[model samples]
Target: MNADQVLQTIKDEKISFIDFWFVDIFGELHNVGMPSYAIDKNSFVNGLEKLDASSIVGFKSVNNSDMILMPDPTSFKILPSDYDPGNRKNARIFCDLYDGSTDESSRYNRDSRGIAYKASKKLKEFGFTHTNWGPEIEFFVFDTINVYPSPYAATHSYGGSGYSIESKESPWAKGNVSTAIDIKEGYYPSQPKDTLEGFRKDVCDDLYNYFGIRIEAEHHEVATSGQCEINLEYDEMIQMADHVIGVKNLVKVKAKRKNKVATFMPKPIFGDNASAMHTHQSLWNGKSNVMYDKDDEQAQMSQTGRYYIGGILSHASALCAISNPTTNSYKRLVPGFEAPVNVCWGLGNRSAAIRVPMYNRNQEKSKRLEYRVPDPTANIYLLEAALLLAGLDGIKNKIDPGDPIEENVYKLSPEKKREYKIGSLPVSLKGALDSLSSDSKFLEDVFTKDFLDVYSELKYKEYVAFAQTPTAWEVSMYADA
Candidate 1:
C-alpha cells in the first residue's frame, strides 16, 4: 500500500498497534509494537522501524550488539481477536534485520533467516525466481507435561484420566480403545469420531481470517489419539519461514484454551507416531513451472528437477544437522514405522526420502517433489533456505540422482541397496553435527565461524548432558549383574 493508503486503512480499520515480528535461529519470535499514530502507509509498507540485536537467541555478547528490522508489506496480517478485540487491533509484518549503522549486512551475520535470505537471493540470481514450498506441519496435543531432573521418575506420563481414553463424545475419544483399532475405527470418523475437527477448523479459520494464511486442508494423522496435520498454501522462501513461527504460536495458544497441550517435538512418545513437517517444493519462472515437463518418459520429472533431487539426496546427511537440528529428531528418523530412513527418490512412494506427488499429472502448479525428512521442530528459515541452495547446486552441476527405487526400499537386499547407492542418515545428534562441521560451505556466508561455533557448542553440551545420564534400559539389563 502507498503511504496514504496504509495510513487511511489504519484510521478506517482503527488498528491500534502495528506489531513488527521477526524470528531467531530457534524459531522464536520477537515483536515490537508501534502505535498507529506513528506509522504512515509509506513507512509501514517499506518498514516500520528497528530493534535491538543481542536480546534474541544464539547471540555471543553485547559488545557487538546491533540489528535493524525492515518490514515486508506482503506479510501484513491481522492479529487474533484476543490480542486486541477493542479499538486497537493487533497485526503483524515480517522484518529484515539490518546493521544499525553500517549497512554491512548484519543480516548476513544472523544465523538462520539471514542465510535463507542469501540463498533465496542466490536462487533469483541463478534465474530460478519462484521457489515455492508446501510444508505438512504435524503436531501432537497432550493433557499436560511436566519436567523434572530427579532420577527417580525422570520420564513419566499421566493422561489416562482425560475423557479421551473412555468418552465417546468426540471423534478421537469415540473409538479410542487402548487395545484394538476400534472394530469400528474412526480413521476418518465423522461426528464423535473426529473429536478435534471443530478445534482444528477454528484454528484454520482464525489463521485465514486474521493472518490470511490459507489452509489447504487438515485431518487426523495416523497416531489416532492426539496426532493432527494442518496444511497451508506455500509462499515464497522467507515468508514461509515467518509463517512457520506464527503457526507454532497459534497452535500452542489455541490448544491451551481447549485444555490441551501442544508439542512439535519429533518423538514425544514411544510406540506412537511422531510429528513431521515434510515439505513439498518446486520452482517456477513467470508462468512456466521449471520443475515440470509436459512430456517425460522417465519418472516424468524435468532434467533440472531430477538433478535438484540429486543435490538434495547427496547433501541429505549434512542438511540434517540444520534441517533436523534437534537431538530428538533422530528418534523420529529411525528405520521402522513410517518415517523415511532411506535416502532416495521414488515416484508416488512414501518410503523414500523424496517422492513426486502422484496427484500431479496435468496440473501445472502442483508439479513438485515432497521431501519427507524434515520434522516439525526444524528451524524453518535456515533449513528451508539450505534445501533450496543445495538443490540449486545440483541444478548447476546437473547432478544425476540415478534410478528411482520403486520397490519397498526397506525390503531391498543389502547388495541391492548398495547397487542403488543409497545411504542412511546419521544415527545420533553428534554424527549429524560432525557431518555438518565439514560439508556445509553452502552456509558459510550466513553460518560463519562464530555462528557455527556457538551452535556446535550448545548442541555438544546437550549431547554430553544426555550422554552422561544413565538410561532405564541400561539399568534393566546391566544392573541385574
Candidate 2:
C-alpha cells in the first residue's frame, strides 16, 4: 500500500486514530497517535514530527533531539476491537525514524529500523537478493508477579530488592497441585495440564486476524512453569522484526486481559528451562535456496551455508551483546537449560550454537541454519542485522567453519572439547560487551562505530549496575559472615 492508499483506507474504514510505531535502540516499541482527521497524503511523506530522541535510551542528546516518524504504509493494520473498548477505531503503522533537526532530514543513524533496512539492502551487494528469518519465540506466563522496592518503598526502610512469580502450571501452585506440570516436562501436554492452550490460540488468532502475522505453531515449551513457544512463519528481515514486535505486544495485552502476566525474560525462574528465541535463517536469490547442495551427503549444506555459519561462529561472542542483551539473559545461557553454550555447528545437534535441521533434508528449501544463542530480550532488528553482516563477512572471506560436532557439547570432556576446537560463549553481559569492543569490525558496515559505541556504553552501565546490586541469594549465602 502507498501513502495515497493509506489515506483512502483511513477514510473508507473510518479509522479514528492512526498510531505511528517505532522501536528504540533496545527494541522496546513506542508509538505516537494522531486523529484520523489530521492525516493526509502529505503526512506520510513529511512524517509525524513530534518525537524527542533525547528521552530515548541510546539516542540523540537533548540539544539535537528532534526526530521524525515516517510511517510505512505496508505495515498499516486496523487493530482489534479489544484494543479500545470504545466507539473509536484504532489503526497502527510502523515508522522509520529520520532526523527532523536538519533541513535534509536524512534517516537517523541510530534508528534501529533504518539499520535493518540498510542491512537488507547490503545483502544485494553480496549477490544475495534477501534473507529469511523465522524466530521461535519463547516466553513465560504467570498467574501473578510481584517485585520488591515498590513505588511506595521510599516511604519505608527497605534495603533489598527482589521479585516473585507464580504460575498455575507449575508444581508450586496454590491449589490443584496434581495437575501442575513436573519440572522440565511441559512439552505438548494435553488440555488438563496445558492450561494456556486456549490463551495461545487467542494470541495466534489476533496475530493473523488483526496484525497479519502468521504463526506456524504454538505449544508448551520444555519448562513446567508456564513456558511457551510460538513459532513465526519466515519472512523478510524487516517484516519479520515488525511481526515480532507486534506479537510480543499482543501476547502481553491478551495475557493481562485474562488476569495473567507475561514476560519474555530469558531466565524468569530458577532450576527450570529458560526462554530462548531460537532463530532459523536462510539466504535466498530469486526463489532459489542458496544454502542447499544436493552433492553434499553429510548435511546437504552448500558452501555458502558453511561460510555463513562460519561467520556466525566467528562473531558469536560479540553478537551476543545484541542477541542476548540483558543481565538475566546470561543466566539462561548456562549449560543445563538446553541453551547453546559452545560455539560450533552441527546437523540436528541442539548442543551446538548452530543446528542444521535434518527434518526434510531432501527438500532444498528446508535447508537453513538455526542460531540458538539469542533470547527474546534482544532487539530483533539489531540482532538480525548483526547476524546477516557477520554471515556476509564469512562469505566474503570464504571462512571455513570447521567440522560439525555430532555429540553433546556439554557432556564432552575438557580434552574432547579442546580437540574439537569448541569454544564457550561469553559467560556474562560484561564479557559479551568486552568481546564486541574488539571483534566488531564485521558489524561496522550497518552498525556504525558511533552506534556500536553508544550501545556498548549503555549496556556496560547496565552490567555494572547489576554487578553492584546484591541479590536475595547472595544475602542468604553470606549474611552471617
Candidate 3:
C-alpha cells in the first residue's frame, strides 16, 4: 500500500487512532499512538515522525536519543478488538527506526527491523534472491496466573482450575475419576481435553483478516494443560518477523478477552513440554529453491543446503545468545524436553538443532531446514538476522556439515558425541553469552558491536540475577546445612 492507500484505509475504516509499533531488543513491543487526524501521509511515510529512544532499551543514550519511525505502508492493519466499536476503531503499523538527527540519516543498528532487512539484503551478494521462513509458534493459555516476586521471596504460579477434566462440565467430571491429560500428552485431544481450539481459531481469523497472514495449522501441542501451536505460511524474514510479533499480540488479546492468559515463555511450566518457535527456512534463487537438488542422495539436499546447515551448527552456541535470549530459555533446552539441545544436523531428528525435514523427492519445494533451537522469547528480527548471517557465512566459506545423525542425539553419551564431533548447545544464558563473546564475528557486520555490547550487558545482568536468586529448591535442599 502507498501513502494514499493508507489515508483511504483510515478514512474507510473510521480509525480514530493509529499505533506505530516497533520491537525492542528484548522482543517486547512498544507503541506510539497518534490521532488519525494528525497523520500526514507524505511526511510519515517519508520518516519525519520521531520517537524518544532514550527509554527504549538497546537504543541511544539520553543525550543523543531522538529516533525516526518510518511507517511501512505495506504493514497497515486494523487492530482487532471490540473495546471501541464502530467509528472509534484502532489501527496499527510496523515502523523501521532510524537515526533521524544525522545529515546522512541511516537505520539504527539496534533497530531490529532494520537489521533484519539489511541482513536479507545481504542475500543478493551471495547470489540468493530471498530466504523464505515458516515459524511454528507454541504457547500456553492459563485460566489464572499470579507472579509475585520480592527481594526476599519469589513465586509464580499458573494453571487452569475450571477447565480441568474434573470440572462439573467436563466429561470426566461425572465419574469423579481423573481424566486429565497426562503430562506431555496434550496432542490433538478432542474438545473436552482441548478447550482452546475456538480461542486459537479466533486469533488465526484475526491474523488472516487483519494482516493477511495465513495459518497452515492450529492444534494442541504436547503439554497437558492449555499448550497450543500455531503454524503460519512461509514468507521472507522481515515480513515473517512482523507476523510473529503480530501473532503474539493478537493471541494474547484474544486470550484475555476470554478471561485467560497467554504466554510465550519458554519454560512457564516445569516437568512438561516447553514452548518453542521452530523455524523452517529455505533459500530461494528466483524461481528455484536453492536448498534443493534432486540429484543429490542426501535427502535431495543441495551442496548449498549442507553448507548452510554446517554454518548454523558451527555458530549454534553463539546464536543462542540471541535465539534463546532468556535465562528461562535454557530450562527448556535441557534434555527430556522436546526442544533441541545438540548442535548437529539430521533428517527427521528433532533432537538436533538443525533438521532437514524428510520429504518425497517429488516435493522439491518442501526440502528445507528446520531450526529447532529458537524459542518465542527471542526478538524475531535479531533471530532471523543471526540465522541468515550464519548460514550465509557457511555458504561463503564452504563449511562442511558432517554426515547426518539418525540416532536420537539426547540419548547419546558424552564420549559418543565427542567422537562424532557433535556438541551440546549452551546450557545457560551465561554460557551462551560466553560463547557469543568469542565467536560473534559471524554476526559482527549485521549486528554491530555497539548494539551487541548493550545486548550482552543487558543479558548478563539477567543471568546474574537468576543465578543469585534463591529458589524453593535451594531451601528444600539445604535449609539446615
Candidate 4:
C-alpha cells in the first residue's frame, strides 16, 4: 500500500484524525497528529513537515536539527483505544523521518524503523526485495516495583514506592520468596497461578483491535512473576519495526492503567528465567517460503536457507551489539533456563542460537529459523534488517555453516562442540560494542557516520554509567575484604 491508498481508505471510512507515528534513536515512540484535511498522499510519502531532530534521544544536536515525517500508508491502522477515534474512526500511519529540504536527509537515521528501511532499499540494489521479519517480544508485568540505584547507593533500598508486591526484595529486602511464581511453572499455567491472564488478554485484544495485528498467540512464558509473550503476524522490515514501537507504547499504557508496571529487561531477577525475544525469520520468493525445500533430507531445508543461517551465526557476536543491546541483556544470555549461549544451529534444538521448529502441522512455509539471542529491548527494525542482510550476504556468497548438530548443544562433549565450530557471543556491553566496531560495514551503511558517531558516544556513556554504579553485590563482596 502506498500514500494514495492511505488517503482513500481514510476518506472512505470517514476517518476523523490521523496520527503519524515515528521512533527516536532509543526506540521510543513519538507522533505527529494531523487533521484529515492535511492527508495529502504525495506530501505524506515525501515526508514534508517541520520537526526537531534534537529532541530525539541520542540524535541531539543544535545545528542540523531539521526533521520531517513521511507517512507509510501500508501501516495505517484503526485501533480500539481511548486515543482511537471510536472503532476504525481514528487512523494512524507509521512515518519515515526525513529532512525538511530537497534531497531529504534521512529523517529516520536515528530511528530503527528508518534504518531498516534504508537497509531494505540497499538490499534491492543487490537484487533482493522484501526484507521480512518476525519478532517475538517478551515482557513481565509486576504487581509493583520500587528500587532506584545510582553510583553511590549502599544497599539499593526502596521501602516506600507504594504498590505492595508479595515477592519483591525492595520493601523488606527479604529477596523474592513465596509470592514469586515457581520457576518454569508459569508456562500455560491456569488463571490463579499465572495471575496476569487478564492483562495478557487485554494486551492481545488491544494490539489486535488497535493495531490490526493478528496476534498468532499470547501465552505465559516460563519465567515467574507474570512473564508473557505476544506474537503478531510477520511483516516487512520497516513496518514491523513500526508495529513493534507501537506495541511497546500500547503495552506500557495499558499496564499502567492496570495499576502495574511492565518491563522487557532481559533479566529482572536472579535464579530465575529471564525474558527473551526470539526472532523467527524466513525469506520469500513471491508467495513461497524460500527457506524450505521439501525435497531435501535435512528437515526439508534449502541450501539457500543453510547459507542464510551461516551468515547470521558468523556475525552472531557482532549482531549481539544490536540484538541484545543493553547491559541487562547479558543477564538473560546466560547458560541454562532456555537462554541461547553459543553460535550454533540444529534441528528442533533450543540450546543453539537458531532453532527450527520440530513439529509443524505438515506445512512447508511454516519452516523458519528462530534467532534466540535478541531481547525485547532491541530496536526491532535495525535488528531484523541486520540479520536479513547478513543472511542475504551469505546467500549471495554461499557461506556454508558446515553442518547442523542434533545433539544437545549445552551438554555436548566439550572437545566435540569446539570441533564443530561452536563459539559464544560477547559477554559484556563493551565486548559487543567492540565486535560491532569491527564487523560494522552493514550497520555503517544503514546508519551513516553521523549516526554511528552519536550512537557509539551514547552507548559508551551508558556503559560507563553502569560501570560507575555501586551495587549491593560489589559492597557485599568487598566491604569486609
Candidate 5:
C-alpha cells in the first residue's frame, strides 16, 4: 500500500491507533503506537518516530541510544486490537530502523530486517533475482503451566498428558489412560486426541486474515503433548521473516485467549519430539526457477541448487549459531528426537540436515532444499540472510555438495558416515559459537563486525550462565559422587 492508500484505509476504517512494529537483534517484535490522527504522508516519509536503542538488547549503549523508525507503507495492515472494544479500530505497520543522528538516515547496523534486505540485494548482484523461503514452524500448546526458578531453586510442573490431565472430557478422568496419545506418536490424529485443532485453525485464520500470511497446512506434530505445526506458503526472504514473527505472535495470543500457553521452545519436554522450524529455500531469477532442472541425473535439482546445498553443508556448524541460537536449542539437536544433525543432503530423509522433499512432482516451483537445523528460537532475518549468503558463496565458488545419502542418517554406522563424509552439526551453543567465530567470513560481507561481536558475546554469555548452573539431574546423579 502507498502512503495515501494507508491514510485512506485508516480514514475509511476509523482506525484509532497505528502501531509501528520493528524487531530487535533477536527477532522479537517491539512496537510503539500513535493516534491515527498523528500519521500523515510527511511523517511517514520523513521518519519522525524515535526509539531508545539502549533499551533494546544488543542494540546500543546509553551514550548512543537514539534510533528512528520509518514504517514501510507496503506493510500497512488493519490489526484486530486486543485492548480496544469500541468502534475505534487498530492497525499495524512494519518499520525499518535508522540512525537518528545521521544526515543520510542510514539503517541501523543491528536491524535484522535491514540485514535481510541487504542480503537480498547481494543475491541480485550475484545473478540470482531473489531467494525464497518457506518455514514449517512447530510449537507446543499446553493447558496450564506452573514454574519456580531462581539461583537457589528451580522446579516446574505442567498438566496436559494423561497422568495429570484435569479436563473432564479426558478419558483419564474416567480411568482410561490408554486413550492418551503415546509420547512421540501424535502425528495427524483426529478430534478428541488432537484437542488443539480448533485452536490451530483459529490461529491460522487470524494469520491469513489480519497478517496476510497464506498458510498451506496445519496439523498435529510428532509429539503427544500438544505439539502442532502450521506451514505457511513461501515468500521473499524479508517478507518471510516478517511473517514468521506475525504467525508466532498470532498463535500465542489466540492460545492465551483460550486459557492455554503456547511455546516455541525447542525442548520443553525431556524425552519426546522437540519443536523445529525446518526452512525450505530456493533461488529464482524472476518467474523462472533457477533451482530446478528436469533432466538432472540425481534428483530434479539444478546445478545451482546442488551448489547451494554444498554451501549449506560446508558451513553447517557456523549456521547453527544463528539457526538454532539458544542454550535449550542444543537439547533438541541431540539424537533420537528426529533432529537433523548429520551434515548431508538426502531425498526424503528426515535425519539429514538438508532434505529435498519429494512432494508435488512435475512442479518446478516446488523444487527446493529444506535445511533442517533451525528452530523457532532463531532470528528469522539473520538466519535467512546467512542461509542465502552460504548459498551465494557456494554458487560463486562452485562448491560440490558430495553424494546424497539415501539411507536414514541416524541409522548409518560410524564407518558408513565416515565413508559418506558426513559431519555433525554443533553439539552445543558454545560449539556453534566457536564455529561461527572461526568460519564467519561469509557473514562478514553483510553483518558488521561489531554487530557480530555483540551477538556472539550475548550468546556466549548465555552459554556460560547456563553452564554455571546446576540442574536437577546433576543433583540426582552426582550428589553422592
Candidate 6:
C-alpha cells in the first residue's frame, strides 16, 4: 500500500485514530496517535515528525534528540475494535526513524528498524535475494504476581522488592495442586490440564484476523507453570521480526484483558524448562532455497548452510550478548533446562546451539538450521541483523564448522568436550558482554561503532544492577552463616 492508498483506506474504513508506531533500540514499541481528520498523504510521506529521541533508551542524548517517524504504508493495519474504547476504529502503521536534527533528514543510525532494513539489503551484496526466519516464541502466564520489599527496606520504612507469581497450573497454587501439571511435563495435555488452551486459541485468532500473522501451531510447553509455545509461519527477516513484536504485544494485551499476567522473561521459574525463541533460518536466492543440497548423504545441508552454521558457532558468545540481553536470560541458558549451552552444531540435537532439523530432509524449502539460544528478551531486529551478519562472515571466509555432534552435549565428559572442541556459551551477561566487546568486527556491516557503544553501555548497566542486587536464594544461603 502507498501513502494515497493508506489515506483512502482510513476514509473508507472510518478509522478515527491513526497510530504511528516505531521501535526503540530496546525493541519496546512506541507510538503517537492522531485523529483520522488530521491525517493526509503528506503525513505518511513526510512523517508525523519531532519525536524526542533523548527520552527513549539507547537513542540520542538531549543535545541531539530530535527525530522523525516516517510511517510505512505497507505496514498499515486497522486494529481490532477491542484495542479502543467504545469500538472506535483505530489503525496503526509501523515507522522508520529519521534524523530531524539536520535540514536534510536521513535514517537514524541508532534506529533498530533502519538497521534491520540495512541488514536485509546486505543480503543482496552476498548474492542472496532474501532470508526467512521462523521464531518459536515461548512464554509463561500467571494468575497473579506479588512483590515485597527487603528486610532492610522494611526496617527503613521503604517498600519491599521481591516477587512471587501464581498459576493454577503450578503445584504451589492453592487448591489446584491436585490437578496441577507435573514439573517439566506440561507438553500437550487435554482441556482440564491445559488451562491456557482457550487463551492461546483466542490470541491466535486475533493474530490472524487483526494482524494477518499466520499461526502454524500453539500448545503447552514442557514446563509446569503455565508455559506455552506459539509457532508462527516463516516469513522474510524484517516481516518476521515485525510479526514477533505484534505477537508479543497481542499476547500481553489479551492476557491482561482476561485478568492474567503474561511474561516472556527467560527464567521466571527455577527448576523448570526455560522459555526460548528457537529461530529457524534459511538463505534464499529469488525462489530457490540455497540451504538445501539433496545429494548430501549426512544432513542434506548445502555448503552455504554449513558455512552459516560455522559462522554462528564461531560468534555464538558475542551473539549471546545481543540475543540474550537480560540478566535473567543467563539464568535460563544454564544446563539441565533444555536451553542450548554449548557452541556446536548437530543434526536433530537440542543441546547443540545450531540444530539442522532431520525431519525435513530432502524437502528443499524446509531444510534449514534452528538457532536455539535466543530468548524473547532480545530486541528481534538487532538479533536478526547480528545473526545474518555473522552467518555472512562465515560464508565469506568459508569457515569450517567441524563435525556435527550427535551425542547430548550436556552429558559429554570434560575430556570429551575438549576433544570435540566444543565450547560453552557465556555463563552470565557480563561474560557475554565481554565476549561481544572483544569480537564484534563481524557485526560492523550493520551495527555501527556508535550504536554498539550505546548498546553496550546500556546493557552493562543492566548487568551491574542485577549483579549488585541480592536475591532470595542468596539470603537463604548466607543468613545462618
Q: Against the unseen true structure, what C-alpha lDDT does each candidate score?
A: 0.74, 0.90, 0.84, 0.75, 0.85, 0.88
Q: Could you give the candidate ranking by lDDT, starting with the highest? A: 2, 6, 5, 3, 4, 1
What are the per-residue Cα lDDT tens digits for candidate 5 across 1-481?
A: 8999999999998889998989888888888989999899886777865789899999999998888888888888887554345656789889888896333439888999888988888976777788789999999887765553344453334211121323322333454354466778788988777888888888887788888899999999988778899999999988899899888877787777678878898887768889999999999998888999989866888988999899988999999999999999999998898998789999888889999988666678888999999999999999999999898889889999997899989999999999999998889999999999999998897987888999999999999988987776776778799
Q: Which candidate should be chosen as best, given lDDT against the real structure?
A: 2
| Model 5: pairs clashing at backbone N, Cα or C within 3 Å | none
Select the stronger candidate by lDDT from 2 and 3.
2
Query: Taking the tens digit of each residue's C-alpha lDDT, what string does model 6 give over 110-208?
Result: 889889888888888889999999999999999987767663552455643468888999988878845599888998988788999999999999889
lDDT of 2 by residue, 1-481 (tens): 8888888999999899998899999999998899999988877778887899889988998998888888889999998776776768999999888885333338887989889888898888878998899999999999988898753343457876678878888887779565699889999998889999999998999899988888899999989878899999999999999999999988888888788999999898889889999999999998989999989999999999999999999999999999999999999999888999999999999999999999876798878999999999999999999999999989999999999999989899989999999899999999999999999999887889999999999999999878976677877898899
Global fold similarity of model 3 (TM-score): 0.93
Model 1 lDDT at residue 408: 86
Instruction: Give me the runs in candidate 3 sitting further than 4 Å from their true place.
Output: 45-48, 82-87, 101-105, 149-151, 154-179
**Which digits, one per residue and each the tens of the lDDT, describe model 1 over residues 1-481?**
5446556767788888988877776667777888878776556434434555667757635776655567666677778864553646876777776665325344436646677777777767668777888899998766565554344343444321211232232233434443222322324555455567887898898888877788899886766455678897988777777777788888887877767778888886666567889998989887778888878865568898999999999888888877787888988888665889888999988989998987647766888999999998788887787789789878888899898879988788889888989898887788888888878775665557677777777777877777776665675668779
Tens digit of per-residue lDDT, candidate 3, span 1-481: 8878998989987889988899998889998888999897565646755688898877778998877888888898888773344547898889888786433238778888888988998999989999999999999887765643444454334221111212211232345234466678888988766777788888888889878999999998888667899999999888899999999988887777777778898886668889999999999998799999889876889999999999998999999999999999999998897888888989888888888888567577788999999999999999999999999999999999999999999899999999989988999999999999999998888888888899999999989988987776676678689
> Each prediction's TM-score against the native?
0.88, 0.97, 0.93, 0.88, 0.94, 0.97
lDDT of 5: 0.85
Model 2 — which ten-residue stretch has the worst lDDT? 148-157
Residue 269: error of model 6 in Å?
Answer: 0.9
Looking at candidate 2, what is the lDDT of residue 23? 93
